[model samples]
Target chain A: MAPVSLVSLGKAFGSIEAVRDIDLEIADNEFVVLVGPSGCGKSTTLRMIAGLETISRGELRIGETVVNHLSPGERDIAMVFQNYALYPHMNVAQNIAFGLRHRNLSRAEIKAAVLDAARLLDIEALLDRRPKALSGGQRQRVAMGRAIVRRPKVFLFDEPLSNLDAKLRAQMRIEIKRLHQRVPTTTIFVTHDQVEAMTMADRVVVMNNGVIEQVGTPLDVYNKPATRFVAEFIGSPSMNFFDGTLEAQGEDLVFRIGNGRALPVPRARGSAYSKHFGKRLTLGLRPEALSVSDASDFTIEVETKVVEPLGVETIVYFDLAGHPASVRAAPNRAPRAGETVPLSFDMTFMHLIDPEDGSVIPY
Target chain B: MVSRGGILANVATYAAAVLIAAFFLVPLTWLVSLALRTPQEIFFGASRFIPENPTLDNFGQVLRDRGFLNYLWNALKLSGLGALGSVIVAAPAAYAFSRFDFRGRGVMMMAILAVQMVSGLVILIPLYRYMGWLGLLETHVGVIAIYIAIGLPITVWLLKTAFDGVPIVLEEAAAIDGYGHFETFLRITLPLASPGMASALILNMILNWSQFLVPFIMLSRDAQWPISVAIYNYAGSTTASTTHLLAAACLITILPAILAFLLLQRAIVSALTAGAIKG
Candidate 1:
């Protein structure tokens, strides 16, 4: 295994820049996921690292050697593609042994390697079957098996589970995570799905508009997002943002959401917001941080619009001061649509941001 | 429980299909009937489905006297060489066009399509002059070379379409698996493109086997002639009997092409269907 680092990487096609200057370092035996919306250059970054794409500018290093000009084969990497690109003519065993055949390994060694990979992926019985004969999940396993047999320095996955059905995607997600544990190669996975990134990454790199927004642990990105884009992009159902202004009242900093409705700011967050006083700001609050309470520090009346019951928890969509927002509540007492619910805001969990630049207030 | 109109429509559809099949088979049936009759009987006997007295003399005469087997072998050799040459030259160019983003790609593709539009007859004199300039006139190599060059545009276009249908992800995956671009194309792309190649080869073989003008203009030696040119010799010869000309030479010339079609029918059907469905 080898640590890979990309410094100030950029890729441009003609006049359009697909990926801008980006720098990231992936540690040895670490699984880093690049997550973003479509056309966000996550896949382009991964391809540049794999040497499948040329880097327009910047340096890429695998361990100590710069690999920007090296061919993909010389880079010693394996990739699982989104479509599971198994060789149609070759059966599962031949597909898995294709890489080993290029080396000077003996036939017996190739067979043993294929067998070991098949056994690891639980696809030994499918060795003789062609790609067309296998089911989607089976083809996925064979694709992974092909990569596993190579045992390259790095493993790249380009949305490998996107083609599978929902149930199979969930199942394969766990399988991939377990496989990473066993192999422990430096892996870079690219996906548009935040759930996959959060579940599988050792460190998640959230990207937007061809730039890295933040790189940290899953919980770290969720809890302490460096920017507003990371805060909204990392969580399920997304974080809700409300336009507000920062003001000082009696030696305390507060965010005024609307006329006469103000929420107290935490001291740590207050220090971050002091420089932006009287300027337009945005407040980000996760659904779980808001709840219904009779005696609360700050109260807001909302008209419930939708209720989603998920056995353990319920999602309540309501209008808060004319802005639509959702709140996750205990399933024991779920609110119904059209009911006016009194919700309490947890000021400590509130996130403040600059509305002009959409950067977090560094709290 | 069926309605009368539905039954009538079904009968009409079946009758139309049978009529079309009969219309297509009638020419071959006539040829077979003429082959069975003797020269005198063909002229004297009444028109019938079967001959009064069938004979194998035409087949014997063509094989023994006319050297039909040699002509058939020459045709096979020329068509085989021409098709192989075209495939070899076209596959790499097609792969490049399909996979790369070079400048003038659109113009190059349009040029290839334009070449296909120009008939071989229109360029006959210029091609002959070029071959003579290269010191290749009156040679089988000259004829096969011309056929390969004429057939390359279509063959390359067909293979390019096939290569385009294969997703780039497959090549990327192969590259990451320690295979270079050329190795990936050989091991993965070419194998996946077998159906398209087979279809193009069959089409090119048919075209080369039935070619008349190029071989006629290039080859002055009768021994170097393909079956098509050889059959034309018999047709134009005034000394040869009409029975031998119609039965022996024509049937002998077409037999190999018919056999080739029969042998590769499955691949041809699948290839045609693949092109249609993909489009």
Candidate 2:
């Protein structure tokens, strides 16, 4: 395994820039996931690293060798495509052994390697079956086996689990993590699904448009999203935003919303916004941070528009001034629609964003 | 659970199909009957649909003819080589058309397709002159070259569509598997496209087998004549006694093409319609 570094890497198709200049260093044996919405250049970045796509400008190095000018075969990388591009004509064993053809391995060595990979993937019984005969999950396993059998310097996955059902995707996610733990190859996985990125990556690189928004451990990105895009994109049900101006009330700061209701910011966190008092800001709140309990620092009464009770927890969606917001509550305590429920805000978990540029305040 | 209306529609469809089949099959049946007849029956009972007494003597006599065997060999050689050569020459161009987005690709494809619209007879004289200047006249190579040229446009189109049906991602997967561009095409794309190549081969074989004018003009010696032209020659010199022999020769010439179609019918149809619906 070897580290990969992309120094000011970019990709352009004619005049349209698909991936802007982005720098990243991926350590050897590290599992890095590039997560973003569709067309966010995550896949483009992965493809560039795999040498499937050419770099428009800047350098890409795998270990110490620059691979910007190399073809995919010359780059010593294996990619598992979204569709699990197994050769339909070849059975599983042949498909898995396909890469070894250029490795100068003897027939016995290749056979043994194929068997070992099949056993590792728990696909020994499927060795003689063609890809068409395999189920979705089995096909995905074979795709992984094809990549892992080569023991290439890096493994590239382009939304490989996107083709599977939800349960299968979850199972494969863990299987991939376990596989990486066992082999510890440097891997770059790209996905539009944030949950996959959060659960799988050693470090999550959240991208937007064509640039990196944040690159950190999943908790770092989730707990302290660096930008408004990261705060919204990384969470299910999304974070809510309210346009407001910060006002000083004694020593504590208060966030005054459009409707003129004020949420008193906790005094311990007030110093971070004291300098920005009277400036327009957007307050970001995670759904889980709002509850019916009075344990929070600030509280507001909202007329619930929808309540979704998902057994474990309930999500109460409401309009905060003019913006949509939701609060997660205990399933037994969810307020019904149209009810004026007291929603408490956990100010310690809140983010104050710069409304002009969508950047979160350092605090 | 077919409804009454559906049953009626099915009956009507079958009736129309049978009528169309009869439109083409009656002459073929008559030819078979003529081929089975004795010389006496062929001479006196030509109007009858069924022979008074059928005999295998005509088939036996035609099969024994050295000239007929030579014509059969010539036809097989020319058609086989033409089909194989056409696919070999067309496959790379087809792959380019299928996979690459070079400038003017669509326009070039249209230009290649336009070649098929022109009748072979329109170009046969010029082709014959060109072959003569190249010292290829009256040779198997001359006739086969014309066949390959005439067959190329459709072969290229058939193979292009076949190549298209083989997913692009498979090639990418092969590339990541350490296979170069040519190796990927050979090992991944070509195998996936075998049905199309098979279809193209059979199609060109059928087209070149029945070819008359090109070989009829390019080949001067009767010894070098393919079955189609040889059969035509035989029909021109037919006497009353040899009419049954001529019918047997016609059946011999037509059987190979029909058998080839019957054998590879599924491959041909699948190649034609494979990519109509994609996942």
Candidate 3:
């Protein structure tokens, strides 16, 4: 497999830019995921790589050659669509062997290749059944088999697991990741699901409004998300943000929310916030980053709203200085709704974002 | 919890449905009774729904006549060939209409609808003159060509609609699998839209099989006359004034059309328009 690279690739439908001039280079055998909200151009970029949609501007290179002018057939890439796109009229075996038929492969060669794929995908017994007869997961495997039989230079997946139910989605997600590990083709997978991105990708490319927000490893982006968009978008039960101002209270760097409630920006991150003394900023804290604290160590007092008991750990929802926020706590320690509680940030996990631009405040 | 009003509404609905069925079925039952009767019974004796001595003699006579057989063959050839030719021409054309965004796609679609929009009678004389200029009159080929022209617009429109319903993603999938647009169309789009194509073919056959005007205008020569034209001429023939013989020939001509309707009536109706509207 060869590397796929995009240099300032941009696509526009008339005046509306679907994808802005974006740059990315996917290394050979890497599983890179483009994760974003819908209409953020992740699918558009994957389609551009597959030669399904035209690259309106900038360069697209699959392997060593520029493929902007190439047709999908000439580009030598296989795509797994969200709906699985198995030809309804063909049986499973024919569907898997479809791509190879166009090549100069012999009959025996095609059969062997198809059987190999069917076996690899655990669909050997289903080769005779038409797509309508198979379950959704089976059809998806057939789709993957179709792609794998081609053994193309690049593999593009556009929300491939979106159609399956939650349990099946989780199962197929592992199967896809496992398939990638075995095959290791230069793969560009696009999905709006951040969990899929975090679980499967070697690198996650976060995007919003047709522009790339950040590109890094899943943990790198998760731990130090470069923008507010990426920071909140990457985690479940999304990170909470409080609109506030940063001011120096002598030795303490205090964040003052409305109603004169001030939370100290832990002394460890003092060097980072020392430069933004009186500037307006947004403080972000995940549910896990906040812990039930005593009044002496408390950042602020919050009135509890709803307590969700999740067996292992209960999630306490409360209004933190008029903004909705949650705190991770033990089930026994979780406070009841309408009761006020003291909470403090884990400090090392806090995300301070610039409201003027949405970029994360650098430490 | 049976409401009096609800029971009355159900009874009224069923009674209306039966009335409508009888309204259509009465003529068909009358036709069968007429075809079974002897010439004496039809022309002079009491006109009854059931004959005193019901006979298949009229059917035997109609089937035995060489002219009648020739007419039947010509009609079958014209309609069958016309339907096949129309589908063959329309499949790719419809696929193009469905998938491609050419410079004149909207204009072309408008033109297809325009063909159906304009009354055939309005263009009949011109079509006749055009066919005459080509010396295409008085032949089965000429009549079939006319049938194709009449069927082409709707066939293309309906098939295009069906092709539209087959997701373009399948074609894209085929392309990624190393097939060209043509192969994708043939193996993917065409097979997926088979129901629509079959509907178009059956509808075209039914249309051409029963067409009285186009065939009547084109195939004036006795050797090339389809059963529809022959039946039309039979109404004017002095030798076939006997009601039983006339009814028998009429039954023969309409039999294929009735059977076509019975077999693919839903197919024809469901594929009337393109995509979401399904007109």
Candidate 4:
């Protein structure tokens, strides 16, 4: 296993830059996930690391050696594609043993490796089946077996779990994590699913428009998103934003919404936001941070627009001073559509963002 | 609950299918009947669909002709070698067209397809002069070379479509698996595209087997004449007197092609439909 380093790595297709010069250093045995929406360049960065795409600028190092000019095989990287990409003509044993063809190994060694991979993937019984005969999950496991059988320097995954159903995706997610724990291979997984990123990655690198927005541990990025995009993207149901200005009302400060509703800034946060008084800003609040039972400094009555009861918790979409907002409340406490309900914004977890640049205002 | 309109549509579809089938089948049936009939029945008897006095005498006569055996060997050698050579030459070129995203790829593919539109008849005299200048006239090598050129464009196009059905990700996976370009092609891409290659080989073989103008113009020696040229010569030399033998010879010339199609129809159909069904 090797630590992968992308030093100002960039990729350009004619005039369009698919991946901007982005620098990242992944520790050996770290499971770093590059997560974003489609066209965010997550896959491009992963492919560049895998040597599938040429890096137009900067250097890439794997295990302290510059690998920018090396081929994928020479760099010793194994990748699992979004579609699994198993050879349709080969059975499971052959598929897993295919990578070993170029190596100087005896037939018994190849057979043992294949059997070991099959055992690790719990696919021992499927060693004789062709890919067409396998289920989606089985195919995914076979793809995994093909990669891990080689024991390459770095494992690259390009949205490997995207093709499975939700239930299977979750199961495979745990299996991948468990496999990593067992082998501790340095892996770079590219996916657009934030949940997968949060659950599986040691660190999540959030990207947007070919640029990395944030790179931190899952909890770090979730609890303290570096930018407004991360604040919305990392959380479920997304964080709601209010467009208004921070107004100083005599002795205290209050955030004035578009419809003239003033949410009082807590005394503890008065000094932190006092400098931005009378300037237009955006307030970011996650769905889970707004509650129906708790009372806080920014409590307001809203007209509920829609209520989605998700078994454990209910998400209520409402209008907060002319801006759309959502809050997570207990299933029994959720109000019906068109009903007026009081939601207390937990300012402790509130994020004050600068409206001009979509960056969170440092407090 | 089928509707009345649906029933009418089904009837119309069946009628159209039957008409198309008859259009092709009637000639084959007539050829077979003539081949089985006596010379008198063909020349003097009433025009009937079925032969009253059927016999294998014509087939026996055609097979007994010493020249026919030489013609059959020449035809098999040319067709088999031409088909095999065309597939071997076209595979790598088709793989490049299918997999690589180089400049002028679209233009090159269009150019190859454009070659298909020009028939051998259009350049028959020029081809003869060129073959003579190369001192390859009246030779089997010259004729097979021309057959390969004639088969290249369609063979490349068909094989390219087949190669397109293979996912590029498989190649990338192979690349990561430590296989080089030639090895990856031989082990992964080639095996996956075998159905398309099979169809291309069979199609080229059939086309070369029925090739008439090329060998007819290039070769004057009866020993080197393929089945098509020999049949044409036979028909010309004994137009009325040996009509039954001529028909029997024509049927023999086409039997291999018909048998090949019957044996490998699934491969041809699957190769053609693979790209259509693939998402």
Kindly report, for each predicted structure in the order presented, the TM-score of its chain A compared with the true chain A: 0.97, 0.98, 0.96, 0.97
- Listed in order, each prediction's TM-score against the native is 0.93, 0.96, 0.95, 0.95
Give lDDT: candidate 3, residue A331: 84
List model 3 lDDT by residue over B1-279, tens digit each. 869999999999999999999998887777778788877677643456688899999889988999999999988999999999898887778888888888999998889878888877899999999999999877778877877777888888888888888988989999888888878887898889999888889889888888888887877688788898887666776343456777788888888888888888887778874455633
- Judged by DockQ cut-offs, the docking class of candidate 2 is high
True contacts kept of each: 0.88, 0.88, 0.91, 0.85
Q: Can you tell me which runs of candidate 4 are displaced by over 4 Å?
A: A294-298, B1-23, B239-241, B269-279
Who wins the lDDT comparison?
2
The superposed Cα distance between candidate 1 and the true structure at residue A88, in angstroms, equals 1.3
What's the residue-level lDDT of B83 in candidate 2? 95
Query: What class would a CAPRI assessor give candidate 3's docking?
Result: high
> For candidate 2, lDDT tens digit of each residue in B1-279?
999999999999999999999998988998899899887787665477688787888888988999999999999999999999999999999999999989999999999999999998788788878999999998999888888998999899999999998989999999888888999999999998998899999989999999988888888799999999999877898788888989999999999999998998898888777677774
* Candidate 2 chain A: 10-residue stretch with minimal lDDT: A292-301
Number of clashes in model 4? 0
Runs with alpha carbons beyond 4 Å of true place in candidate 1:
A293-297, B1-26, B44-46, B54-57, B64-66, B238-241, B262-266, B269-279
**TM-score, predicted candidate 2 vs. hidden true structure:** 0.96
* lDDT comparing candidate 2 with the true structure: 0.91
Tens digits of lDDT, candidate 1, A1-363: 899989999999889999988999899999999999999999999999989889999999998999999988898888888988898888999999988888899999999999999999999999999999999999999999999898989989999999989999999999999999888899999999999999999999999998999999999999989899998998876887888788899989988886558878877766667788998888899988888664685788788899988998989998766677899888988778888888988878888888778888875
Would you list the clashing residue pairs of candidate 1? none
DockQ of each model vs. true complex = 0.74, 0.83, 0.88, 0.86
Model 3, position A350: C-alpha lDDT score: 79
Instruction: For candidate 4, list the clashing residue pairs, or say none.
Output: none
**Residue pair clashes in candidate 3:** none
Model 4 RMSD, rounded to 1 decimal: 2.2
List interface RMSDs for the candidates, in order: 1.1, 0.7, 0.6, 0.7
